[model samples]
Target: MALWIYRRLPGAGAAPRPVHLAHRIGGAVLLVLSLPIAYHCITAYGVQMDSARVALHSLAGCFFYGAFAAKVLIVRSRHLPGWALPLAGGTLVTLIAILWSSAALWQLAQP
Candidate 1:
Protein backbone atom coordinates (compact mmCIF):
# COMPACT_ATOMS: atom_id res chain seq x y z
CA MET A 1 0.00 0.00 0.00
CA ALA A 2 2.85 2.37 0.76
CA LEU A 3 4.50 1.61 -2.52
CA TRP A 4 1.25 1.88 -4.34
CA ILE A 5 0.51 5.17 -2.68
CA TYR A 6 3.89 6.54 -3.68
CA ARG A 7 3.74 5.21 -7.23
CA ARG A 8 0.24 6.46 -7.83
CA LEU A 9 0.70 9.74 -5.99
CA PRO A 10 -2.11 11.45 -4.05
CA GLY A 11 -3.20 7.95 -3.05
CA ALA A 12 -5.05 7.42 -6.34
CA GLY A 13 -5.14 3.61 -6.15
CA ALA A 14 -7.60 2.06 -3.79
CA ALA A 15 -5.71 -0.10 -1.31
CA PRO A 16 -6.25 -3.75 -2.00
CA ARG A 17 -8.27 -5.79 0.48
CA PRO A 18 -5.10 -7.30 1.88
CA VAL A 19 -3.50 -3.92 2.40
CA HIS A 20 -6.19 -3.01 4.90
CA LEU A 21 -5.69 -6.28 6.71
CA ALA A 22 -1.91 -5.88 6.75
CA HIS A 23 -2.16 -2.38 8.08
CA ARG A 24 -4.37 -3.43 10.95
CA ILE A 25 -2.38 -6.53 11.81
CA GLY A 26 0.98 -4.85 11.46
CA GLY A 27 -0.14 -1.93 13.56
CA ALA A 28 -1.15 -4.30 16.34
CA VAL A 29 2.20 -6.06 16.15
CA LEU A 30 4.09 -2.80 16.33
CA LEU A 31 2.04 -1.66 19.30
CA VAL A 32 2.55 -4.86 21.18
CA LEU A 33 6.26 -4.97 20.46
CA SER A 34 6.78 -1.37 21.46
CA LEU A 35 5.07 -1.36 24.84
CA PRO A 36 7.39 -3.36 27.05
CA ILE A 37 10.47 -1.82 25.51
CA ALA A 38 9.03 1.60 26.08
CA TYR A 39 8.13 0.73 29.65
CA HIS A 40 11.65 -0.47 30.34
CA CYS A 41 13.21 2.56 28.78
CA ILE A 42 11.10 5.11 30.58
CA THR A 43 11.31 3.30 33.90
CA ALA A 44 15.02 2.61 33.69
CA TYR A 45 16.40 5.94 32.55
CA GLY A 46 13.67 8.53 32.06
CA VAL A 47 14.77 9.62 28.59
CA GLN A 48 18.40 10.45 29.29
CA MET A 49 20.91 11.13 26.53
CA ASP A 50 24.06 10.35 28.48
CA SER A 51 25.35 8.19 25.66
CA ALA A 52 24.90 8.30 21.91
CA ARG A 53 23.19 4.92 21.69
CA VAL A 54 20.89 5.64 24.57
CA ALA A 55 20.11 9.05 23.15
CA LEU A 56 19.30 7.79 19.69
CA HIS A 57 17.22 4.95 21.09
CA SER A 58 15.27 7.28 23.33
CA LEU A 59 14.69 9.86 20.60
CA ALA A 60 13.70 7.20 18.09
CA GLY A 61 11.29 5.73 20.62
CA CYS A 62 9.63 9.11 20.96
CA PHE A 63 9.30 9.42 17.22
CA PHE A 64 7.99 5.87 17.00
CA TYR A 65 5.18 6.55 19.44
CA GLY A 66 4.32 9.80 17.70
CA ALA A 67 4.24 8.07 14.34
CA PHE A 68 2.17 5.23 15.75
CA ALA A 69 -0.42 7.66 16.98
CA ALA A 70 -0.43 9.49 13.69
CA LYS A 71 -0.87 6.27 11.76
CA VAL A 72 -3.79 5.27 13.94
CA LEU A 73 -5.37 8.64 13.36
CA ILE A 74 -4.79 8.25 9.65
CA VAL A 75 -6.55 4.92 9.73
CA ARG A 76 -9.51 6.25 11.65
CA SER A 77 -10.02 9.78 10.32
CA ARG A 78 -11.58 10.54 6.98
CA HIS A 79 -10.83 14.26 6.89
CA LEU A 80 -7.12 13.86 6.15
CA PRO A 81 -5.79 14.34 2.64
CA GLY A 82 -5.37 11.12 0.66
CA TRP A 83 -1.58 11.08 0.77
CA ALA A 84 -1.50 11.41 4.53
CA LEU A 85 -2.25 7.85 5.60
CA PRO A 86 0.30 6.13 3.44
CA LEU A 87 2.85 8.77 4.20
CA ALA A 88 2.31 8.26 7.89
CA GLY A 89 2.44 4.50 7.59
CA GLY A 90 5.61 4.63 5.58
CA THR A 91 7.22 6.96 8.09
CA LEU A 92 6.38 4.55 10.87
CA VAL A 93 7.88 1.68 8.95
CA THR A 94 11.04 3.55 8.15
CA LEU A 95 11.42 4.56 11.77
CA ILE A 96 10.97 0.98 12.93
CA ALA A 97 13.65 -0.20 10.56
CA ILE A 98 16.03 2.44 11.83
CA LEU A 99 15.27 1.64 15.47
CA TRP A 100 15.74 -2.06 14.90
CA SER A 101 18.95 -1.48 13.07
CA SER A 102 20.39 0.89 15.62
CA ALA A 103 19.27 -0.93 18.76
CA ALA A 104 18.62 -4.61 18.15
CA LEU A 105 21.23 -5.18 15.50
CA TRP A 106 23.69 -3.03 17.38
CA GLN A 107 23.27 -5.14 20.49
CA LEU A 108 23.68 -8.34 18.53
CA ALA A 109 26.91 -7.07 17.05
CA GLN A 110 28.39 -6.09 20.43
CA PRO A 111 29.34 -9.62 21.50
Candidate 2:
Protein backbone atom coordinates (compact mmCIF):
# COMPACT_ATOMS: atom_id res chain seq x y z
CA MET A 1 0.00 0.00 0.00
CA ALA A 2 2.87 2.36 0.72
CA LEU A 3 4.30 1.79 -2.70
CA TRP A 4 0.90 2.17 -4.25
CA ILE A 5 0.26 5.39 -2.40
CA TYR A 6 3.62 6.83 -3.31
CA ARG A 7 3.11 6.07 -6.96
CA ARG A 8 -0.51 7.10 -7.00
CA LEU A 9 -0.01 10.86 -7.00
CA PRO A 10 0.04 13.58 -9.65
CA GLY A 11 -2.71 12.27 -11.98
CA ALA A 12 -2.15 8.60 -11.39
CA GLY A 13 -5.28 6.53 -11.91
CA ALA A 14 -7.31 4.82 -9.24
CA ALA A 15 -5.79 1.70 -7.78
CA PRO A 16 -6.99 -1.66 -9.06
CA ARG A 17 -9.16 -3.85 -6.89
CA PRO A 18 -6.35 -6.38 -6.50
CA VAL A 19 -4.10 -3.74 -4.95
CA HIS A 20 -6.71 -2.89 -2.36
CA LEU A 21 -7.43 -6.56 -1.80
CA ALA A 22 -3.74 -7.28 -1.37
CA HIS A 23 -3.35 -4.54 1.21
CA ARG A 24 -6.24 -5.83 3.31
CA ILE A 25 -5.05 -9.42 2.96
CA GLY A 26 -1.54 -8.46 3.92
CA GLY A 27 -2.74 -6.59 6.99
CA ALA A 28 -4.80 -9.56 8.09
CA VAL A 29 -1.90 -11.94 7.60
CA LEU A 30 0.44 -9.70 9.55
CA LEU A 31 -1.99 -9.33 12.42
CA VAL A 32 -2.52 -13.08 12.57
CA LEU A 33 1.21 -13.76 12.54
CA SER A 34 1.99 -11.21 15.24
CA LEU A 35 -0.54 -12.49 17.76
CA PRO A 36 1.32 -15.67 18.60
CA ILE A 37 4.62 -13.89 19.14
CA ALA A 38 2.89 -11.33 21.30
CA TYR A 39 1.17 -13.99 23.34
CA HIS A 40 4.46 -15.78 23.95
CA CYS A 41 6.25 -12.59 24.90
CA ILE A 42 3.56 -11.53 27.36
CA THR A 43 3.13 -14.95 28.90
CA ALA A 44 6.77 -16.02 28.98
CA TYR A 45 8.66 -12.83 29.70
CA GLY A 46 5.97 -10.35 30.87
CA VAL A 47 7.78 -7.13 29.96
CA GLN A 48 11.14 -7.37 31.68
CA MET A 49 13.22 -4.24 32.18
CA ASP A 50 16.45 -5.76 33.36
CA SER A 51 18.46 -4.20 30.54
CA ALA A 52 18.21 -1.35 28.08
CA ARG A 53 17.71 -3.59 25.07
CA VAL A 54 15.11 -5.78 26.78
CA ALA A 55 13.21 -2.75 28.00
CA LEU A 56 13.16 -1.13 24.59
CA HIS A 57 11.99 -4.35 23.04
CA SER A 58 9.26 -4.79 25.60
CA LEU A 59 8.06 -1.21 25.25
CA ALA A 60 8.08 -1.43 21.49
CA GLY A 61 6.13 -4.65 21.64
CA CYS A 62 3.49 -3.07 23.86
CA PHE A 63 3.20 0.09 21.78
CA PHE A 64 3.01 -1.79 18.51
CA TYR A 65 -0.48 -3.07 19.22
CA GLY A 66 -1.69 0.29 20.40
CA ALA A 67 -0.38 1.92 17.27
CA PHE A 68 -2.06 -0.77 15.24
CA ALA A 69 -5.38 -0.12 16.93
CA ALA A 70 -5.01 3.61 16.35
CA LYS A 71 -4.26 3.00 12.72
CA VAL A 72 -7.32 0.82 12.35
CA LEU A 73 -9.46 3.52 13.89
CA ILE A 74 -7.97 6.11 11.60
CA VAL A 75 -8.74 3.93 8.66
CA ARG A 76 -12.33 3.48 9.71
CA SER A 77 -13.04 7.07 10.64
CA ARG A 78 -14.15 9.67 8.09
CA HIS A 79 -13.22 12.74 10.15
CA LEU A 80 -9.48 12.13 10.36
CA PRO A 81 -7.05 13.99 8.15
CA GLY A 82 -5.63 12.21 5.11
CA TRP A 83 -2.13 12.03 6.55
CA ALA A 84 -3.17 10.22 9.70
CA LEU A 85 -3.14 6.78 8.10
CA PRO A 86 0.32 7.10 6.64
CA LEU A 87 1.77 8.57 9.82
CA ALA A 88 0.34 5.78 11.95
CA GLY A 89 1.49 3.21 9.38
CA GLY A 90 5.00 4.62 9.35
CA THR A 91 5.08 4.49 13.14
CA LEU A 92 3.95 0.88 13.10
CA VAL A 93 6.59 -0.08 10.57
CA THR A 94 9.28 1.60 12.62
CA LEU A 95 8.12 -0.24 15.72
CA ILE A 96 8.19 -3.51 13.82
CA ALA A 97 11.73 -2.80 12.72
CA ILE A 98 12.76 -2.02 16.27
CA LEU A 99 11.17 -5.20 17.55
CA TRP A 100 12.89 -7.22 14.84
CA SER A 101 16.30 -5.73 15.57
CA SER A 102 16.07 -6.01 19.34
CA ALA A 103 14.81 -9.56 19.33
CA ALA A 104 15.55 -11.46 16.10
CA LEU A 105 18.77 -9.65 15.24
CA TRP A 106 20.07 -9.86 18.78
CA GLN A 107 19.33 -13.56 18.99
CA LEU A 108 21.06 -14.23 15.69
CA ALA A 109 24.14 -12.31 16.79
CA GLN A 110 24.68 -14.47 19.87
CA PRO A 111 27.51 -16.99 19.84
Per-model TM against the reference:
0.73, 0.89
For residue 65, model 2's alpha carbon misses the true position, in angstroms, by 0.6
The C-alpha stretches of model 2 lying farther than 4 A from their native spots are: 5-13
Candidate 2 clashing pairs? Answer: none
Instruction: For residue 86, give model 2's deviation from the true position in Å.
Output: 1.4
lDDT values for all models:
0.79, 0.90
Top model number, TM-score:
2
Off by over 4 Å in 1: 1-19
Across 49-73, the per-residue lDDT of candidate 2 in tens digits comes to: 9999999999999999999999989
lDDT of 1 by residue, 1-111 (tens): 456534564646676778767866876996998799889978987887888877877788889899988888887899989889878878887888878887889999996
Q: Number of the top candidate by lDDT?
A: 2
